[model samples]
Target: MSQAPTTMKASILAPGQIAPNILSSIVVFLVALPLCMGIAIASGVPPAAGLITGVIGGIVVGAFAGSPLLVSGPAAGLAVLVFELVRDHGLVALGPVVLLAGAMQLAAGLFKVGLWFRMVAPAVIHGMLAGIGILIVASQLHVMVDAKPLAGGLQNFGALPGRIWDVVTSKQGLEAGLLGLGVIAVMIGWEKFKPAKLKLVPGALLAIILATAIAQVAQLDVARVDLPANLFGSIEFVGSSGLAMLLDPTLLGIALAFAFIASAETLLSAAAVDSMHTGPRTKYDRELCAQGIGNMLCGAAGALPMTGVIVRSAANVQAGATSRLSTILHGTWLLGFVVLLPWLLRMAPIAALAGILVFTGFKMVNPKQLKELAHFGKGTLAVFLATALMIVATDLLMGVAAGIALSLLLMALRAAYLHVSLKKDEANKTAVLRLTGSATFLNVPRLSEVLDSVPDGTTVTVDMDKLRMIDHACLVLLQDWNRTAHARGCKLVVDWQALEALSEAGSKRGRVQGLTTT
Candidate 1:
């Protein structure tokens, strides 16, 4: 008797898998905890909000997300947006706007716009992520030194030198010293240690834990996060502005921005997860729905909006996580910490979080990948650099839009310049052209020009015997031309063998008919 298909299927979390998930979850929790607090404090929201979002993302999205390896949580990509929103609308007004943003995400998921993720060029996406990484490193510099985070992004970047000078001269030097040492240790450990080889130990987590323990034992007067104050601080679910704020146009605009950025990040991360999977493919629509639900729960619980984070997902994979159970376990650990070990969590050093982010930022800007983009074309590099610059100078959305627009324009120009001309024959009232080279959407304009410039009352015969490629765009153009010539009292004849040759050259695997001139 044959075994049932269900019985033959392999389980991602088979017996021994549970141990790795539990261990990886603990590592991810330690990694996420201080980051959650730091980003929230930096955004001017209560620190607990970030942790709350991480918990919700793990528990809610992790349980249902299509990508089993991806970890959902508060992303640094939204820091500038969150900070600007709070600055413009006041922290009190951010809650309702976040809720509205969650609803908008749900609506987008329902509309099946998740499929649009494929339309975005890979170059533009990489550029957006690289820019976000740079911004993260720059923004976290202040927090690493125990100084209050500055408001505007680029404008504040200019003050870093002066801030460093002040830190070097003041008594706060002791605190800065301890933080710097911790940052160095974390960075070195992450660079040198492989958790798999070490078993049950993540270098980043160990570095942070050791740093926090040392700080406590030495009785350092340096700045340390107060446990009780950081944890359980005043959290108001409904802000004073309430319903009116929900309907406010300005608030709506902010919420839309948040939703847009969050969705882009999540979708991009989901796409990455799809590429990493060796088994079955993930459903993007389902992933979007899960993200929407996760973000809504996050906002409702007084947390920042959540999204799938590539760094954490990569970490989960590196830690040998094979299923969503790892993500669920990570969230479970965070929840346990909030309930039972809030004090221990408060001992986390801000510098350690900064080190982790800095390491993550470095991974984002891979020189080898940039070199590969250069080989593709200058347009790819332009989009990548422009996006990176825009994110640094303005914001993520604006930068990404600018990069995409440039890429599209370049594609259009390339198409328009690719001409395919025909040689006229007055004796036989016929014209012939041997199409050669690749023809894509970029060549549509040239294809149109060649078709329109032919003299009236002539027989046009396109010989595609030498043509190497013809994409859908060129095929559509050819069909339209065939129709136009018939209506104009001219003749259009396409050879069947030639068409077959062209299709084979194009690798399109379709044959066209030999139609006589009308």
Candidate 2:
């Protein structure tokens, strides 16, 4: 009875699990509500679209999810990617891109390629998150004042200082800015000072609730959430334009990006959630399929793409979730709230949600991670900086691509890398050529030069034992040099057995001067 084969569904129905599941679901629902609407609003879609993603993520994905306690929903991680698509191609293209991305994820899960995402370098992941964070903060600053953000990340950043001054000096955007600021302050203060009894209550929920109340009490004129009375009214399914756009190369590329980023984020969140709870380990491929189902339904319903969200999942675990029942019930709560109290959601000032997102975006930067990255080495830190800065200066796809390229290049250099040195004891009539790094075809030329530098008619010892690795190319070169050394009356005192052993071990490992030192 391995844990992997255990069906969590049966466990969910156990009477012993009921009370904890209900309590955790309520906490998760509270955590997710603001984030769902906020992420959707940030992605330039209607408020209801986010809620739609939340419902599908909980009900559809939860039932099939491999990580029983993990929660899923619309996430800030993909907001920048979605916002760019909506800005350039119009809202119509979003559905098809999401639909196609979901299809790709589903196919990948079926093929069991979910584990391949684990190969993505940690530097690239952190860098990508940091980059996304910068973009979110830049864009949401405008939203905080009830204004549309500038076209791109750089543009938003460039205009940020002037916009802040405007909010301070003028009546135009002052009230909304103050409300957004208050929301941010409350969230920070609450997280730092909330009582032990209220620790399970999410700061985002409390902050937004207080902000919404203040807006009403003060009779504020700031913009409110634009949720519709009827949930179906907000959905605009994949139109003809969206369908046609799917065939276009640019949109297809976007879809592929969506699949890659979403899968990485989802699987990573599942892993994080698993660490938070001792109950079950994640069955990655199954969890991926659940995400696929959730995202597919979200796309069909004209909603935002969803991922296993760490925020709500953390809340679920901390609140005492026992099984997938808590995750599923959270979605039920979301649907109930949306259907019954659309007015309450609509009454929430848009600035409040924007403020929460801004705080979230700021947290994503995590400046403390810089020191940790630097601890690994300059190269690791370089990858982090390159990825983060490139995403800010250019775009998400290109930044990630650049980081991967640099990481691979460094790896290749390390594999084919070699160092050669010659030490001659002329008084003793002996010359020793030392090789101390990976010896492969890439290092052959330098190996030949060092061997040639040894004086003729002198006993030469090529120190093979010092070598980290040796491939066939270097071995053959050494054998050729051995023949020439003998012909030239120089005795080559090389331990062929040890050298051959190194080559055989490396070959068995299918490495031609690879990561394993032999």
Candidate 3:
């Protein structure tokens, strides 16, 4: 007798399986806590909003998630967009934008539009991540020194040198900077040399916890994580906004951008997580729907938008998470800490959070990714660099668009070479013009010249046997040339059988004099 489907699912979620998940959840929760607060503060939203997104992403999305081990939360990749939106439209307007973006993601998933995002070039994706990493590192460096960056990635970068000098030279600044550096040092050292059994303890969490403890014990005069006594007071419902703001082109653009990045990043992270674990593969469309719903809940509750996050997900897998229960439990832990242990959070130094994020940002610009691109080819490296630099100099959407365009351009150029050969059979008064390789609009003039040099009406046999591809423009040129040669009574003949399956028009014009496949 076989077990029922419901029974099988229940068995998978049994109490025995939950113990490891619960343990993993605690590890992920610790890893996610500082990141949630830091990313929110970085995005210029209240830290609690980030916690809210983490809760929704874990419990809400995890309940329905297809990638069992993958965790979701507010991503640093979306931080730049959030900052820009909050800067331009005010915090109150963000909820509406998030709500609309969530709706779009839901529609996209339902329509099976998730596959389209996978079409983006890998270089562009890596470059986007690298750019976000650079931005995060530059911006957080200022925060680590207890200062606010001016604005934008470029401005922050420009001011970095002066800020570093000021921070290192001051007594207060030196203490804060060193504390942040100490946190970074702990994370790095732990990663390089943690005991085999203790490896499950996430380095980021340990670093923050240790740093906080030391700061408290030493009575350091440093800025700490500031949370209101009533954490609920931080929730601001932005369900309604002015009609003009809702309809504003900028607002709509930002929403679309958010939706695209969130969806793409979530799917990518899910895919990555699946590679690390053999338990279950991701159902991308279902994951999208879950993410969409989670984001919607977050927006409704006036929290940050959420997506599948690689860092926490990887940590969950490393910590032995076997199912979505781990993710859900981690969110529970976050909620419990925020509601019941606000004092623990208040003890964390702001610079410590900044340092943790800076370390995360550095990891994002992974040397492995860059090296892989280099090994692929110069063109791949070029696209990667261009996309990364553009993203840093411009905004995220524009940089990706540029990288895609460049990739397409390179593909077209590589596929555009044409090989044309003409053989004259003087004895039979027949000239066989052999065309090979790609024939595009770019090579139309060369093809036209070859056709014109042919003596008028000498039984021209235009053979496309070696031809790989021909564009519509080149086909039209061939047709006009055929007509002219026919008018001259010089018999132009060609076979269309070779190209019939290649073009709709070619099949219809079978046995024509100068047939082309486009």
Candidate 4:
């Protein structure tokens, strides 16, 4: 919004921009490769589906993206929802549902509702991510050992101990599990102690390459990533059957949910990407629109839904990307790889990609964020934990619903909070009524009771300095009482300036005009 992002747009194909953008695109491509497949696998879809989303996200979304360096792709955050959708309605419903979701996003962006997503409680967002992370980790643990994940997040989590036991007892399972663990270790180790010279090389890419090398060297019979002979031939076009899904009310509801979550995730990621660079600030509505179009295309192709992912976006920025060319090129590279070299992809072990997701899942929990949330207050922390726990117990929608419910309850309680104390200064022949906390319609009765108990006024002073807010209801009550206070030979004293400042705008002048002041 600051500079309109025009300068960056105009220079997309500038002379010096080519090499750096290309270089950064390769870096982002390397980072995105495994994640594309892993997220799709987690979403209960094939690897090519994720690649299709990546391609659309980069080339299509990037073309219209407001944040030049931010990379969009199939995200882990939405994997749980997609998994549930796939589980409930079958894979055939996914394309239609995602298509509807994209249409909804496009409409929202047109209405300029993109900023509203930011109003979601930070605790809720983080907690939801944490919950999804837990689900991903629990489910992928089974995949790491070449086992099938259970039906639900709780089931997957509950089955962990049994899964470990199975790995210990079965030789083949043990080999796959050990290989997965080794990948995890490699990722963690590289992050902690990678040489400064090669820091730009992602740990994920290294881990996958090492995993493929190990699988080949050991001749391990683990399940590997399955890619089509020709990626273009694999696209599942939304035909007449897919379009029929629009008639189902349940699928429509799922589409709405998808749109909301995807938009929120995209805008939030764009905000984060903006902070990482000084070049151009994100125009959120534009970014949302771009994402909407991208998802629509992805849905048409029966691919996984896409959102702006922070990891790859961060990689793009750090790798010295100067324009949207980097984002577009990354998608080109992905499309090119799967088309020309599907054989190479077939060699990468599924256990290894699952391990990468496991690592990603743990990082998503982000316990360090708890400290920051704590600064807001205990209620926020409670919301965070409740959201995470509920997701583990139920599902993403329920967890988010619970968190939003709790957050609203907290707001209601705070808005109506009022503590009134009356002090009688007999020696001074006066009474002082003190107010603390917000004063709204909820507190009017208690406030009226205190005002009525002032013995018909012997110079009572209503002190509201400690009150955070005083609404019109309380203000009108005081004004009405003050009008009659003189009937007792003395006026009720009030702080007019403070009350005016605390009062809601537009009505403040009118309320303060009639209220008697000391």
Which model scores highest in lDDT? 4
- Poorly placed runs, candidate 4 (over 4 Å): 1-13, 444-459, 465-518
Error of 1 at 45 (Å): 2.9
Ranking of predictions according to TM-score: 2, 4, 3, 1
Each candidate: how many clashes? 1, 0, 1, 0
Model 3: lDDT equals 0.82
Write the residue-wise lDDT of candidate 1 on 1-518 in tens digits: 12121111113657876887777777677667766776676566766788888888888899988777778898877876787788777876767777778888788778988777557787887787788777766666776677666665585688778777877887564475456557666657666765656644555566667777777887665555544543445455765557477777778877887887777778888666656545445667777788888877666556688878876776676566767888888888887787687777677666656655655565676666789899998888988999888878987668878988998998876644444768998787789855766667877777788778787888888776556656667776777777888677677788645554454343443322323322
List, residue by residue over 112-215, the lDDT tens digit for candidate 3: 78878777788888888899899999888888888886677899999988888787566646666888999999999999999998988888889988889889
lDDT of 2 at 163: 91
Candidate 2 residues lying further than 4 Å off, grouped into runs, are 1-13, 239-241, 421-426, 444-458, 466-468, 476-491, 496-518
Residue 484 accuracy (lDDT) in model 3: 76
For model 2, residues 64-157, the per-residue Cα lDDT tens digits are 9978888999989999999999999888888888988888889889999998987888899889999999999999999999999987899999
Ranking by lDDT: 4, 2, 3, 1
- TM value for model 1: 0.77
For model 4 the TM-score comes to: 0.89
Worst 10 residues of 1 by lDDT: 1-10
Best by TM-score: 2
Q: Give the per-residue Cα lDDT of candidate 2 at 306.
A: 89
lDDT of 4 by residue, 290-367 (tens): 988998999999999999999999888888888999999999999899888999999999999999999999999989
Winner of 2 and 4 under TM-score: 2
